[model samples]
Target: MNAFKPYPLRDDFTLKNRLVMAPMTTYSSQDDFHVSEEELHYYKLRSKTMGMVIIAATSINDQAQAFDKQITLKSDDYIPSMARLAKAIKEEGAKAIVQLHHGGRMNNPTLYENKEDIVSASAVPAPREGMVTPRALTEEEIHQTIEDFAQATRRSIEAGYDGVELHGANTYLLQQFFSPHSNRRTDAFGGSLTKRMHFIDMLIDRVNEVIKHDATEPFILGYRFSPEEIEDPGITLNDTLALVDMLKDKPLDYLHISLGKYDQSSMRDQTDQEPIAQKIQTVLKRKIPFIGVGKIETRESIDHALSLGYDLVASGMPILVDPNWGETIQLNQPIKTVMPDTLPKPLYDRLAKYRERFQQSGYEFPVEND
Candidate 1:
């Protein structure tokens, strides 16, 4: 039971097991950006069997809100709702982590009263269809955004969460700063890879400063990042390796790699023979724990990811289909990889689109007839 073995993150913080529930956007919060009953229930239902549960990407500032039902940590007023959500997950015996995020250019213009409110690393429009060109954040605004992350960390600690995971993946603000394709700034924030990394470095420093000054309990800080992007000037394996080298000595609890498959090869450089995670680990040299995630749906996939030198394995779709995944593993019972008909209507509705996509991807998450 390697999966069930307790894992120490720091002297003060440890996981009951190595199984993490990867953060998945729920879009179940209220229009006011408050945690909703459905969202709490969603987490409570899934938290029972996991060592740690990373909540969906939550907006750190009001203007950063991107989705209609996104959760927020922009103000003290929202702390109560966050506390309730944390309590719901923690009561199930899992460490609750809220992912702090800013949508940047990915922000929906419709959410803002003024369209120019949307901001990113540069004024470049997102490559995604229908996305508007975002306003480039000023140097002061960039500094302010880093402070916003620190504020969010303080709020997470106040809300009784065990930790906060910085959302640096999925083409968001952090990735926008790191990706040359998105960032055209000529200033200290973007140009050379080192300058591009300045934003992330400052961000980590600020968040850790907040934890050092404020956190009274054992708090873990983790970072999640994508390894590669498809654009010519986008993040490549070499760039990711460089970034990993920079982060190797940071006071981070873990580095989570965002991928579609645990063993997926580099998208940009076909000449690279190793998996992206393995490459990252090579540079990291086990300085910190690495959490690998993709379409991991079975016990065998979890075992394989661990065998590949990942310190922990995370799953998203499998837990959505089977809430008791870890409990079943502990009981030595066969795991169910398909969504059952008895799944709550709200949850099933939330997963409908993903269910279709998972089916097409050949990952078995069949939806039983209601």
Candidate 2:
């Protein structure tokens, strides 16, 4: 399949091409959890090349925030803020997708002024050192959380977005509710694998209801997920395969697998060498579009991903480093490895602190030596 060709979705929504901008958190929102002018500029700068741009994870509520400076869609009041972001991307001729998120156990209490206790499916702390054990939500709160997601979807529609991607990957609230390591509840929401998926299943149902009622256009809905977790007894390949089975026929436009490399193999079982994306695709069987992302930098890498049979490809860091990534690739221009001085300070500092990550990926991050 040609990478530059338009890909059509249900209800007449067609992507300009098979390339998408992966959702990446910038830590650049305003104090009130609204999109800052800097972030709008950032999106506007990066939106020109892709068929769709999935904005960084935005909190669904105040409590859902995982870090300081996260964008929120917690209430109707933030609609205009999001509308501006949607307009920024859409005006560039790319579809804008908001990633609706809740931090759950990953919520850092210090980010909250009062330091509220974080909630999860159970009272399990993340396996990382110094992590606090979270409070399990009462059954009532679980239902309320579902409603929160639905309301956020409604806001995204009103804000003029082309779609919303449920932020289920990256060990966030949705993944926490599904992971055996995080969700230990004995109720209908946890226990067996089937039970652990209850929260996600219900959440999807609610979000769909909102789309059916609120969306004036052919809105896109997608789900993103990690194929496995490194923690002991955490999500495994088999577990994710089962998840793909459940999500394949759901009211979704695509399934995006989060990974360090698009063709990465199983982490838990090193002996299983099959790339996890290919495994999930075997189960998906073309039921829904599959977006493959991870270190997809150059035109060659994008072509390689397409050779692997992905329906669409997502570009992450390359777009951040170079706003004109697509244009450069189309013109056979060299991609930049150095971090530009023009980025938002927080995002720049964060990337600078972790410059070694870029080096490890064979991408340079040469900063100006002032």
Best by TM-score: 2
Q: Lowest summed lDDT over 10 consecutive residues: which window, candidate 1? A: 338-347
Per-model TM-score on C-alpha atoms: 0.94, 0.96
Residue-level lDDT of model 1, residues 57-126, one tens digit each, is 9999976887767889999999999999999999999999999999999998888888788999989888
For 223-291, candidate 2 gives per-residue lDDT tens digits of: 999989999879989999999999997899988889989978998989989888778878999899999
lDDT (Cα atoms) of all candidates against the true structure: 0.86, 0.87
Worst 10 residues of 2 by lDDT: 108-117
lDDT of 1: 0.86
